[model samples]
Target: MNIKLWIDKGFEILLDYGPKLIMAFLIWVIGNFVIKLITKGLKSAMKKAKYDISLSKFLSDLLNWSLKILLIIVVLSTVGIETTSFAAILAAAGLAIGLALQGSLGNFAGGVLIMIFKPFKVDDLIEAQGELGIVKEISIFTTKLRGLSNKEIIIPNGSLSNGNIINYNTEGTRRVDLTFGVSYDSDIKETKSILMSVLINHPLVLNDPEPTVNVSELADSSVNFAVRPWCKADDYWTVYFDITENTKIALDKADIEIPYPHQVEIHKQN
Candidate 1:
């Protein structure tokens, strides 16, 4: 008799809880399907609108996960679980998390600023945070760069955004400023003529700036002339290197010697 009574009590418990369990499960299932559909639809729309792939994917995933969490909370509440205390605890936990990740949050904000303002893009050579490199990637917390020597550098976005950035590729053309020094005795007019000839003949040099060749300074050892030439950004280094080497050759051919610092013999009162 006791066994039968226990069995009847168990059946009553199942009957009372079965409908609630089924309803909770249905809510979860339906909510999950709805979330997936909405997320996919939004992603498709954004893609069709030519949105950034990374941003679209991130937004879609965040929305889906958030909706899933809300659905789970609703399901739990339907099963008679106390949600007010749970929500309070979650709020406190979120606050603590935010405080702990203050720097990361700043980086994230800086990253947003970078994306919006777009000071530089991938493969752009830039100087930021006392480092110079080509930008490799821009993430939520940091920007990655690969140096000319193949070294990898990671800079926090906050520092990068706050500090000055020199973007070498911002303009289509760049000026290559070179200073060449010659002996004090060398004819300045002849040297200037030779430099002008080389610059004018070079195909890469732009004509608008007119290839400035002027006496920049008189040093202790020699007289220096500034050679400023404008060329396309991609060809700046190549043109600079060629012009420097060729200028020396041309000066040598013209018998203009480059000065070397040395001590003069003032020996002998003895």
Candidate 2:
């Protein structure tokens, strides 16, 4: 008798919940498929809008998760769960999560600001947080950089957004400024002429604005000349290094002496 009673109760429960369970399953399947389509469309729209890759990815993920949550709520409600109770639980959980993830939230917000303002983009050489590098990628919370030494650097967007950023590639043309010192024995006019000739003859150097090589300072050991030459931003580094080394070689060929520090001691007779 007891076994029969248990069997009857089980059958009644299954009957009561069977349709609801099936409906919930259907909703889940259809909702998930719809979400996929929506996210795909969102990605396409973002691409058409020319949105930043990092920002677009973040937004898509956010939307997908949010929609899935809503779909789950609807499925639960269909299975006889109370919507009000579910909402209250969600509210409390969200509060707890927000408190626990303050820093991540701040970073996310900063990333949004960066995407909007666009201080730096991928491939731009920038200086921030006392580090200089080319931007490799910008992510939801972190930005990646390729350092001059080829090391990968990851920085939090929160700090990056708050700190000062020096974007070296914003201007199409960059001025390569170099300072070289010649020995005091060298004639200033001849040294200047040599420096100017080096700059003028360089094919990469822009001639429209002209290059300036002038005597900037008279130090104890040497006379310093400031060499300023303008070149396309993409050629700045190449020009910088080439001009510096070439100037030395040119000066050597011209017999101009580059100054270096030396110490002299006179032996006193006892």
- After superposing candidate 1 on the true structure, give the runs of residues whose Cα lies further than 4 Å from its correct spot: 1-26, 41-60, 208-210
Q: Model 2: per-residue lDDT, tens digit, 35-65?
A: 9999999999989976678789889999999
Model 1, range 191-235, lDDT digits (tens) per residue? 999998888888999998678899999998899999998998778
Model 1 lDDT, residue 197, Cα: 84
Which model scores highest in lDDT?
A: 2
Model 1, global lDDT? 0.87
What lDDT does candidate 1 reach at residue 238? 88
TM-score, candidate 1, is: 0.81
CA lDDT of every candidate: 0.87, 0.92
Please identify model 2 stretches exceeding 4 Å from their true place.
1-41, 52-54, 71-81
